[model samples]
Target: MNEKSGSLIDSLERQGVSRRTFMKYCATLASLMALPPAVGRAFAEALAKATRPSVIWLSFQECTGCTESLTRSHTPTLESLIFDSISLDYHHTLQAAAGTAAEAAREAAMKLNWGKYLLVVDGSVPMKDGGVYSTIAGVSNHDMLMDTVKGAAAVVAVGTCAAFGGLPKAQPNPTGAVAISDLVKDKPVVNVSGCPPIPVVMTGVLAHFLAFGSLPELDKLGRPLAFYGETIHDRCYRRPFYDQGKFAKTFDDEGARQGWCLFELGCKGPVTYNSCATVKWNDGTSFPIESGHGCLGCSEPDFWDAGGFYRALSLPANPLHVAATAVEVGAVVGVGVALANRAGKSAAKAGHETATLADLEK
Candidate 1:
């Protein structure tokens, strides 16, 4: 099948997708990319004319969890449909052609789209013993990545393994696994670093690329700021509890039952950055914190070695300068209280406005 022969709109229209549906998808993509609302229409027009870009997906020394996260957790939404719009020429896990045929397809796509294709990697590359630990068609993963990325326009590291070495590069480091950025220096690399990034986030990145012909603005970690800009703690619904110093001591405690902060129970939300709290998983059902568990900080680098999961970040310790510590805590708490008071007042005022004049006169 000639996957790259037509524009995305052509493919969608052929697939029975309405123009309105496509426009809505484009708008959603715009919102996900944090682009202004006006850009949504621009995105629609650009994407309609944009040809489906050839994509080469590479997997190395890691589990297929990232792929599962992208495919399994969501209903067949427009985001998943967008995947169909891209000419995903290579993906060992999903491709029908196997072995030599698959390898031939990848080589052909790379040759045809050289310097214009997107190379997406989902696993870390093993660098030990001439990269013998992981190989495809007897070709070392490290060598394949190096050779493949040479002609690529941009490389997207799709999971923690591809972005930060992940569990494979954790303590002991048996495979000597390294992230894509460590090896691919020439191409602009975007890291979507999560144990398995949110499905919409995965598609959003691809959509942004398709609409803008460039990667979205990224943070220091090479992760798109639209998705990884804020800490989970900052976005968590229970964050007010943290500011108020109301925390759950035990999993089944009243505070926990009341949906108070889980910081005392070893939540890593404060340090973790991802769209889980907002974009969520399982079709926007709930995230870990919403399910009453603390964040595992899976999105950050070397999270596997970030101490015990059950150890709280705010553990009390004897401070040499108690006065200084108290002052800092007081300032934070004061700000929290002020914000809470303001929110409460706003809500109360809104409620009062809803009262009818007839009731007021009575």
Candidate 2:
């Protein structure tokens, strides 16, 4: 490693991390982001030379679930190495200072790192009744957010609350809770939307930004495409069951015990886009589907108001159309699997027979 890289390595060491471990982390991040091996080296290089960007984390009308999710991210260590690596200037939950002192520290960091720091926000901003629903340090959450975001280089809305108003914005929303995008219009914003976003996804977004000095390209919903590009159904292990029309009708049905598809049980995996099926949780141990539970589509907009969790999705009108039931989907998948297996066998036999013909002719 070069001098700049050496300095970065030293910093990591001071933080109780080894150079080899840091490189391994870069490699893992690169693979998850679908970058080439060379890109991993580049990421390490960037992280080594770049100055730690100041981050200001704001909390509002939320349950602190987003913070809980981030803290629970499954990295190499129990403590969050990624979050600790950054220069977190202000966080109400983590900071040591209290009252006016903490507020002063936030203002100082904002001014000093103006247009160069990052703004991370959780929860929604109440817009009704002149934003009186939530307050911080004698200021409304709306005002504090606006003031903090004005000079930020970029903003990351860290949960469904900050991204899509979450539970606070449910029907007949009394507080008129609004997402970060609804309030901050000038800066580039990245929304990590889930009831509480996956911890890896949260850190991955930060890692990407830290490595590239810019936010990753996002979908229409301001979610990073690397993690939210494909629907959960596209990569689900239970996909075969769905295609075969096999399904679990109830929580304790035969199909449920057999690990059949959960479409009939109100799984929204087909419509929800996330990396849950692939990256999974608790160190890639299992996702909701793998545990025999259907997806709740928590990452999508207005998920809280999306109706019953166990209600089945309506299928097409045609009789030939596959029913949305897991059993039927599994049966259809079984037929497809059988045909594919036969085709493979036939191709192998043809190749073997052709070899004999060629030898005889020679």
Candidate 3:
């Protein structure tokens, strides 16, 4: 076999990752994905004999934050997901080649691996004026993406920018920026959406692909369900505080100091989907909520244009009105919380005002 040709386990072994550790990783991933233990063993076996796939990373109309998230953060370390598993053939930020030679390298990798390589795009593609807004080596982002995607086995739209048109496609989009999904209809596109998606989430998606040779189960937005299955609100530790109506009205208040829910302070966690609450950042240090800030809902589409960051989700401010609205609207998903909070604020008036989980089900 050639230098780049080998099973993943063999390379991991050479790189100092033990089989026991690798298997443990597999088991964790399997459980995280809601798969049986047998599937973990199957994954381990599949990766042990599978050939490393070639990956081409393209960047356009974006900050380099997405690149930094994976390369700079060492969690789910490079030895397991990046360096030893996939042959990353082209990455604008990481590769050493420049100018014509760089373009040549991309062309060569595409030609050699034709129809089998993975295509990863991290930024939005500008469509105005034939994509003159953003270019690499004098080639437009639109042109390059279309040309490269022609030969890719599957396309991974990393970060919210590439997945949902992000900031580049915000109101008054000057560049006419568009997401990868808007362009690539023929290929199976997997959207990993986050401002800079959790690093371990990126790792998990890649690992699933390497083991199964197919994209993981996806949500309605084409995001991997393994990672995007629950909203940040679902896993947030402050959920109990929200249920109890113990809200921090401002950045500095008794409730705020007590670590109450940030919902009233404009947290979009209730509607936003991501793994930030669980996976976290900076080596599992903490996320925005953990550090006393509300979620900006950066993972969902058009979060940039969603409105003021400090503007709380639209709901009834008065408990009496909330109760009326809940009855009028049939107590929809979010209305239940307001009704529950009614009991917290006026415990003496009526104990029956508390909206039960069973009431929510009804």
Best by lDDT: 1
> What value of lDDT does candidate 2 attain over all alpha carbons?
0.78
Show model 2 residue runs off by greater than 4 Å. Answer: 1-8, 73-79, 315-362
Q: How well is each residue in 215-297 modelled by candidate 1, as lDDT tens digits? A: 88899989999999888877899988877889775577699899998765567787788888887878888999999989888
lDDT of candidates 1 onward, in order? 0.81, 0.78, 0.79
In order of lDDT, best first, we have 1, 3, 2
Candidate 1 all-Cα RMSD:
11.6
Output the lDDT of residue 49, model 1.
78
Residue 104 lDDT (model 1): 96
* Cα deviation of 12, candidate 3, in Å: 1.5
Clash count for each candidate, listed in order shown: 0, 18, 0
**Candidate 3 backbone clash number:** 0
TM-score of each: 0.85, 0.84, 0.85
Minimal lDDT window, size 10, model 2:
353-362
- Candidate 1, residue 8: lDDT: 87
